[model samples]
Target: MPTKVKPPPAVTFAHPSEAEIARLLDFYGVRWEYEPRQFPLEWAEDGRPTKHFTPDFYLPDFDLYIEITTLKSSLANRKNRKLRRLRELYPDIQIKLLNARDVEALFTKYGRRGEEMNATKAEK
Candidate 1:
């Protein structure tokens, strides 16, 4: 029987192929919390429970929350509703969203840049 090999941890978003928006946060030195689960407690006009939404990362340093979406469909309406509700629930909190393409582009560009910088240093 062959032993399975797990891939090494990646420093580049490209390695995981998810575009890794975390790199952007790291680049900006923003402290972040990932996969935070939040339940809705507010009620509708008729006093029905609100919907639950989970944002991707929470930046404590910036006092902002972020969501990264890779779905093909534009979930703008759903995202907006969640943000609005979240604001009403937590007045001081801010939410930021980044789409898949945006994150992927950043990863490709920055990952290449990092590689190039390393090669240059190696040559020197």
Candidate 2:
């Protein structure tokens, strides 16, 4: 069966949660461009048809690609395959995977609104 692929959203890096990671970048005066919108398939030598992979963040300045996965989706074969393909295609490209707990912890530790907000929401 032929699967359909959706176009990447018109999202920018500014949307990343203003937690420790982001704050740390800011504190260190590091600048990065996120989701520049180049097709992953372009990196493939054979030009075979493959599912498009949209990672969480693309740090152009550092030449790194980040993929953040939750607990459920992290374990999926699809994720593993994508990781493998990325590794095969671009061995030098840095790939980062973050779990949900890390994200929440980031939110709790350095979230602009503070972890108390998260706690209140979780209670509900």
Candidate 3:
């Protein structure tokens, strides 16, 4: 009897930029996880987490978390604050934030248009 093969699970990215990043990582043979962990940034009076920040990719080989943001300036500023708070709370945690311009450059280098960076959200 032949054994049944299970298909790999599908990954859904919050933004097109994330998918591009995944492709780049795959091209380089780097192992990565998408939104694997969330770090609590704020706690309420009752001790529950009020806010959390989840990075886009976690590279196990490099022990690093990367966040790619192509949002507008206002939204990017919020992300910056969250990153700052996360670093303050977890100084040992390694993280890198790729801003809009950085992401654009990456896309350009890889032959992807800047507009495609955030063209749509939640793409499979």
Q: TM-scores across all candidates?
A: 0.55, 0.53, 0.80
lDDT of 3 at 115: 43
lDDT of 1 by residue, 2-91 (tens): 999995464333223223456455555667666556747477999777777777777787777877765456576677677787878878
List pairs with backbone clashes in candidate 1.
Answer: none
**Model 2 lDDT per residue over 33-85, tens place:** 45544437433557765556766666777878766665776465566677788
Error of 2 at 37 (Å): 4.1
Ranking by TM-score: 3, 1, 2
Off-target runs (Cα >4 Å) in candidate 2 are: 1-30, 37-48, 74-76, 111-124
Q: What RMSD does each model have against the real structure?
A: 8.0, 11.7, 5.8
- Candidate 1 whole-model C-alpha lDDT, 0 to 1: 0.64
Decide which is better by TM-score, 2 or 3.
3
Q: What lDDT would each prediction earn against the true structure?
A: 0.64, 0.60, 0.84
Model 2 / residue 82 / CA error / Å: 0.5
**lDDT-based ranking, best first?**
3, 1, 2
The residue-by-residue lDDT of candidate 3 on 45-124, one tens digit each, is 99999999999999999999999886688888999999999999999999999976887687678765534434432252
Q: List clashing residue pairs in candidate 3.
A: none
Best by lDDT: 3
Name the regions of candidate 1 deviating beyond 4 angstroms: 1-19, 37-50, 108-124
